[model samples]
Target: MSGSDGSGPAGRDHPFDAAVALKPADTGDGTYTGATHPAYANMVGPYGGITAATLLEAVQCHPERLGVPVSLTVNYAGPVADGEFTVSARPSRTNRSTQHWSLELTQDGRVITTATAVYAARRDTWADTEATMPDVPEPEAVPVTPMPDEVQWAKNYEMRFLDGALPALEGAPESPDSTTMLWVRDAPARPLDFPALASLCDVFYPRVFLRRGQAMPAGTISLTVYFHADEAVLADHGTRPVLARARSNRFGRSYFDQSACLWGTGGELLATTHQLVYFKG
Candidate 1:
């Protein structure tokens, strides 16, 4: 409801709803507009995860939504200024079981983000999981690290860090390993769904900050997520915390690559994500 012009659904009853609330306006054929809320705002723009979810929301709101998400890729072209923004989603292809969509988000008439998603009607198939869940203490065993006041997005979720944190900027030694293991879930126990799961995939802090232990200028340029579980898995998960692990493989001149794995409480691989981030030293 932050940017609603009395045209869209007034559903800010939950934080996840508030994060992806889109005000549908009759802009034209296949084009829509929505407002960004400060509740999910980041340093320079709204959180990339919420923006990604909003793009998916556009497709879900469309009358021709295909199925649940199988994979999604979002590219942050420019900063999404706080205020009204436009999102457009179009079906590129629809097959027997899978559908493909392309979307773009703009503010002030300039494209700030672009995304592509693939959704499909799943069925029983041969399944095998090779990734093992990290052996760690239970979510309740780990202490929740209070989010700093400056980060609005961090406050929306409860992050229990098992290892890796912002190193003291003063004279802190660089960590030999850049991996982090944590348990994450909505702060107020929101139900796990496709949209919420998409947002949670990006809840981890940028790998650079976690490794260097100092907040440098960094942001995700491209993010991609592959969903391994179906709707039933998420519904069964309820409000349980997800076990997540993230690590960086390479950091080059101006970009770095990081990969993360998300697992359900019963050791099911829910999703795997990778991102190329832009950073300034």
Candidate 2:
């Protein structure tokens, strides 16, 4: 029964919303500035308009707390360059357990991106589900690997893939559709807040999706994350490889489908996700 306001969704609860926008084009190297959009401070990445999940994360992705994402949507029509830009978020709906929101990205007076997201408290019923995480290699056992040029954020976390783009692996088959399996954790143990937790998902934009020989940096227009009940128990699990799986429903020049999952290495199901991505030229 929750919905949006006429202008932008009015905040019914929470104070995590932010505003960002881009500044005048700089001739220094034809790059974007953060002065125009401070919300997008990660100058190294595509930084597509902040996704819907971010809006929700601002309110819910706190570590050492209890929260879950039901859905996240992002409509990216413009790019937030290195230049300064502005972004804002507001709640459109909030029920007993669920909350919804809308956000925007702008540059030099022009609107380029929009998004919506939903969050909910993890429920007790989910604990009974049987989604299991497959056994995997320990983080310490694997050699340290360099982060991908485009996936610079990965440097902060340790990762291992249960099912990567290897040409051959038992049961690990290839597909034209995009998908992937990986494990990630921040070194030195950062606070597991919603923003930090969501940052893990951030490294997994649609562009990073790969299947068989299919791999690309997927910039999502929309993203939806579903907490699989036991996510709160992630700490009980070690830094071992967790179960992760992703898939794409569609892929196009301007649009695509994406999703992912996170679970305990012991086969305990934790969370699953889906996202819609919009690419830039």
Question: What local lDDT score does residue 192 receive in model 1, on the 0 to 100 scale?
Answer: 81
Clashing pairs in 1: 167-213
Winner by lDDT: 1
RMSD (CA, angstroms), candidate 2 = 11.0
Stretches > 4 Å off in candidate 1: 1-12
Taking the tens digit of each residue's C-alpha lDDT, what string does model 2 give over 45-105?
Answer: 3444234334444334222222455555556565556554555555667677776666565
Candidate 1: lDDT over CA atoms?
Answer: 0.85
Per-candidate TM equals 0.93, 0.62
The sequence of per-residue lDDT tens digits that candidate 1 reaches over residues 79-173 is 99888899988899999999999999988878899999999999998889999898888999999985677889888888898987545556777
